[model samples]
Target: MDDLIVKVVVRLAGVYENHGERVYLDAGHRALLGIARAVQDEAERRAGVGGNKVEGPVIKFPLDRAWREKKDRDDA
Candidate 1:
């Protein structure tokens, strides 16, 4: 396993041993929340806000192609 993953597992085990199951679960929950928040923040940074734009690669989703094709069909 990766070093970071190993460290997190060790830390969580220590938490469970010292605090109990509730604290360990809370720690894991909080870590997941942090990861989700970071992803949202990064997405907003890349997508920009208001009329202001940022210099970054555009992220295209699979649904984007379907939408474009639908729009083209409608226009034709």
Candidate 2:
């Protein structure tokens, strides 16, 4: 999985445009958020916020619960 992500980063970096960097950064941020969300404990998640003054909760559900909710919502 880490290798796959590294490959994606390399591919994104190869693109010769400013927008490619923006997209790559967005993907990186999402990856970090996913990692943070996977960790248990609200305090840990909050710590992951790292002094950023975000208005709401930093992380959502774990991957499984998030997928299940998404599937349920889609089925409905």
Candidate 3:
């Protein structure tokens, strides 16, 4: 499950770069969050866990912040 998440993230990052975009907007962040949540939820459900409980900090918060910072620095 973790591997799947990593793969998805890497693929998305590649797509973003290939598209000539230095930063992602809310839509991109939401897409990432949706993918992660879906994968995690499915894994939990398969394990007999009821309800989607994402353990750990929200991935988008840090990711979006870091990307924005990088974009700002690059623009400057």
Q: TM-scores, in order shown? A: 0.59, 0.33, 0.36
Which pairs of residues clash in candidate 1, taking residues 3 or more apart in a chain or in different chains?
Answer: none
Name the lDDT value of residue 60 in candidate 2: 41
Better of 1 and 2 by TM-score: 1
How close to the true structure is residue 3 of candidate 2, measured as C-alpha lDDT?
100
What tens digits encode model 1's per-residue C-alpha lDDT throughout 1-76?
5998999889999999999999999999977876786677677777874442435755433468789899999999
> How many clashes show up per model?
0, 0, 0
Off by over 4 Å in 2: 1-19, 41-76
In model 1, which range of ten residues has the least summed lDDT? 52-61
Please tell me which predicted candidate would have the highest lDDT against the true structure: 1
- Return the TM-score for candidate 1, rounded to 2 decimals: 0.59
Query: Model 2, 27: alpha-carbon shift in Å?
Result: 0.3
**TM-score, model 3 to reference:** 0.36
In order, candidate lDDTs are: 0.78, 0.66, 0.72
> Between 2 and 3, whose lDDT is larger?
3
- Model 3, 25-73: lDDT tens digits are 5446877778787788778878989664657764445458788899999
Candidate 2 backbone collisions, by pair: none
